[model samples]
Target: MVTTPRITPDLSTNVGALRLAFPTLMASGCYGSGEEYAPFVDLARIGGVVLKSVTRFPRLGNDAPRLVPVASGLLNAIGLQNPGIDAYLERDVAKFAERPCAVVGSVAGFSVDDYGYVTERLAARDEIDAIELNISCPNVAHEGETFACDAALAERATRAARQATTKPLIVKLSPNVTDITEIARAVEAAGGDALAVVNTVRGMAIDVERRAPMLGNVTGGLSGAAMRPIALLAVWEVAAAVRLPIVGQGGIETARDALEFLLAGASAVSIGTANFTDPRAPVAICDGLSTYLNEHGYAALRDLVGAANPTFLGTR
Candidate 1:
């Protein structure tokens, strides 16, 4: 009897200086530092784990009705609620270090100094594999405008964080900007090691009966399937504009959805809102991606990166 050989494609990839075992990461704010879903899935099997956003000080977040379900997506105004970086380092960092996967720390701030302070501290921690700067949060220092929407401000923030940390810096871009590539170029020029395109798009919903906004914050970040197309376009545009790797995410719920981002030039993909429904989604997608590569005759996962680009195919 002859047995068939099992084919395993290389799923490893790099996002800036950090190397990942796979290309599917658990998006920030989805896994909550990989504690909540530890029992449901094998966190080690996934590519990386991006923890929830933390600040220098603890945040109470928005009022009631922070998360609202929308058509094919979710609207959330969590306001970067976290227990502060000091608390996270003292309590959670040790647990995170025990995990086999790469651990990424997500930091949000109200000022440039705030970004630098948090990043400098996290960079000193050997457990943190990388730092993701969440500049999409409303900048209280800039009249409530998100730093990511302003190229100059974004560059300054990225530069401050870059100077504060030797660890790989991944800036999370906002899709609410007029032109995403402008922000992408600014980050790259400011010394960002990579980009995560993007954070959720700004959107809102109204309660017809009450005639009021469903979210207490009036507007919330739109995530899930509703934002995939926007994410794909942003990744495609940024890929053309900069030479940095990208972690493309929006509404990725399955392996095929992840494949779209890779074909558009993403070095990796992140699973976010989908985790709300399925705790095992990221791991499942990883398995499916390996299956896709083997069945499609692709030698490795990196071979699919930017495969759909005309220039890459010599058709442009």
Candidate 2:
């Protein structure tokens, strides 16, 4: 008996109009400007890099003792430290043109106006292929994550940014909310082209010796293997609630971990804490995904999206 040759699996995907050669993206704040990892990994092999978030003004970030090691994850309170948007546009934006893959600029803000202003300036850069509106950074004080935790606020922030630029907008959502789906639906209605389901979960650590909080800020965002289940559930729920594409993140490491998110209905997967362990983790995941697809007689990565979730409403 003769068998037909299997075709190579197609891994390409799109976040709005921004085409990614692969479904792997370097999560914002995890991989500094793509330049930092070029020496350790092949930039062309991956999809893109979501640059560290920039605010309307420069920030000093949180104080010392910013990172704490936990049982299966890490807690951090980085506070979105970065040069102001003006300096970023003058000094940083130009360098992104040299990157081999897509460059997505991340914008963090304290108000709807901040989101709109920063997004307009960042998205206007020719080097920026897309925008990741970071409305859910829990590391910062009071207003940082408030936009994502409330449905109406989330919609207003998304709409403000949406009106600022035609660039593809990916709204990052918070897992700390009571009903994540409500916020996801609101963002979609507000014109978000895609959704980044589940940023790091809010957590804290204590110092028995000092009898004080481990993190200088007292509270931090938790990420790594411990949050995989939570992130997966958010992706599943959000995918079922909106038709936009979803980028699943939070605590992903191995190929199996990434696969779980795709099967649950994520159109793509963002690599964050995993990069801290291995810079080449993204390449490894792509290789593993190809092997799995061939073994299962699948023709493309999109075929696996939403495969395990019957209620999934997003497109593959």
Judging by lDDT against the true structure, name the best candidate.
2
Candidate that would win on TM-score: 2
How close is every model to the real structure, measured as TM-score? Answer: 0.96, 0.96
In terms of TM-score, how similar is model 1 to the real structure? 0.96
Off by over 4 Å in 2: 1-6, 137-145
lDDT of every predicted structure (CA atoms) = 0.89, 0.91
Write model 1 residue lDDT over 1-316, tens digit each, in one string: 9864668889998887889988988999978888788889887789889989989998989987999999999999988888898887888788876887999999899988889999998778888999999998767878987899999899999999999988999999999988998999899899999999999988999999999999999999999999999999998888888888999999999999999999888899989999999988888888889889887888688888888865332110
